[model samples]
Target: MELEVKPRIYVVRLGGDNPKLSTALKLVRLGYAVRIHAKEIPPHSVVLNPFSREILKPSDSALLRRYGVVVLDTSWNSGLEDLRSMVGRRRYEQRVLPVLKAGNPINYGVLTKLSSVEAVAAALYITGFKRYSLEILSKFKWGLTFYELNKEYLERYSSTKSAEELIKVQNEILRSMGLQP
Candidate 1:
């Protein structure tokens, strides 16, 4: 009998604004994620970066399983600056999630404005951890709704075998929504 090794999930908390509404802290409390400092981020791990040029795809599952995934928790106001500071220095594999609507009350229906947990779940789902993704999202009342809002996109993104294919699907989706790809 072998115990299944759960892939590590890490959150780098740089934004202390509105701690009460922070989804990243909630994840730590629920034991679904671990809180670590920016400097502690593992090398070659997948770091969710909104400004990243690389798109996360199913092909990254093996890497994720071996190196783990990370989500940078920062306020929208300081997000870009926070990301910029960490982008080039760390040997992290930064990835950007394709367009997806937010399910959190604060940013509901807004595209690509996901909470920390939502971003983590999206990365998990895209990396072939669908069941684990749903598990984490189930902890929050609006978490599952995130999946509901972007089910079609999530499904299509997860089905892609490579980043190029994933980008193609995402472009088509954007075009269909009348948004420039």
Candidate 2:
């Protein structure tokens, strides 16, 4: 909604029947420029990590516009382990998404821990592709619900001009939720 940058999207799937994978499939079906990799991904792509301390914000949009976006698809319970085992072997600009409420069945209304689709959508939203994000979510029944639940936080992160400002806002929200930031 902010800019017209259309960078390619890539998903490194680790064999999961999860919503994240479902969303990735939907993204591919929707004619979005998406590449699915079951093995190692390209080193130049900007990767998303649930364990990273670097909260993604509006400032990262330019980088994504230039290098594209990458999401690692794995099971929620084994996310860190899977990412570490798989991603640790590669070099990527890893970043975490800002705080958002989950709308998925397993973790609905929960903070920060988003499903694969939600994480990708959040990144897309913060990086000036709000419409595209919504479009991706539209493929599923709960997609709009996820967007509505985290709309405020998504907008705030998307509006931030710098990573520091985004981090400050993210910290405030997390603190209010009694979450360890």
Candidate 3:
């Protein structure tokens, strides 16, 4: 009898590399299917990642087709240079601003990404507003914590545990900018 072996395949998610990839893999390695992404694409059908096109694959395109294409572009081949172009006249002012102030891109150098969004929100709240530590929100399962929704934050926005919840979170984020908790 003859035997054949196939090389194991791994998918390195698009966008920025995820540090927790290994940790996540460890939890469900056997008899499990996993999806990992480097950056988060907004609610869109198509994404254009001019930078690091290598990350895009046939499967990526297929997966993206599910959404309505909230994000038209994914990354810049020269990401930093692209960022530089985006800043332009504001270049000097940008350096002085913190990562959070720079805007909410899923891939912001070492800044917080979608995986870290929930805890980052907590950190932002703790450090910038309540002047406390974010020991609580850190334990949340998602990028945003459902229990921590303060009255003020929920006032302008609504809440839910389903897909619709994303809208509320997005709304709260707009108002939460620079204000902290």
Candidate 4:
């Protein structure tokens, strides 16, 4: 059974001066439902956050299909305040993607800090839209690197049915890599 992504994706850019070559902007060029400096957020959508405790799992596909996904576009340096402000603006279901390596030049091989497009693609992949995820990642040269590095983890996360199970698996993966969970 192929799961379809229903809710349109919405991105809110806090204040990072748009870079000349931006992954988020690349996502926009690829015809994704991206909105920069979005003023309003749809209620009940799954908002992607690196800091959120609620792990995004394959089981959340139902919700993604129903309410769509929202991404917070901010720089790692100056976006935290913006994220905090946006959190209270609307009632959104926050979710964090499982452990994954970055393919972006800035944070390649870094854990958990994924580019905006990578985060969106990861969510799409974990939720069973593998093709869509790949299609989105194809826009960047380094995109494939992200997939190659985290393929196993992504596959593992995609196979889990619940957030709890995914979290347990993520913990194990972290431990194996000599990282503290």
The most accurate candidate by TM-score is 1
lDDT of 1 by residue, 1-181 (tens): 1114457899898884687788988988888889999889899899999988788888888778899999999898766788776665558899889888899998999989889999999988877788888889999999999999999999999888788899999999989888998
Give the runs in model 4 whose Cα sits over 4 Å from its true position: 4-7, 36-39, 88-90
Q: Candidate 3 has what TM-score?
A: 0.23
Candidate 4 lDDT tens digits, 25-92:
66666678677454566667888987676889887887788777888878887778776654444477
Task: List where candidate 3 sits over 4 angstroms from the true fold.
Answer: 1-21, 27-112, 115-165, 177-181
Q: lDDT per residue, candidate 2, 1-181, as tens digits?
A: 5677676788776654655446665666677646567445555566888767567877677778877888776777755677766444446677878778989877889877687778888888998988878887887789899999878888888888888999888888888888767
TM-scores of all models? 0.94, 0.85, 0.23, 0.90
Best by lDDT: 1
Winner by lDDT between candidate 4 and candidate 1:
1
Q: Least accurate stretch of 10 residues (summed lDDT) in model 4?
A: 81-90
| Candidate 2 residue spans exceeding 4 A from truth | 16-21, 38-40, 86-90, 178-180
Q: Give per-residue lDDT, candidate 4, residue 92.
A: 72
Ranking by lDDT: 1, 4, 2, 3
Q: All models: lDDT?
A: 0.86, 0.76, 0.27, 0.80
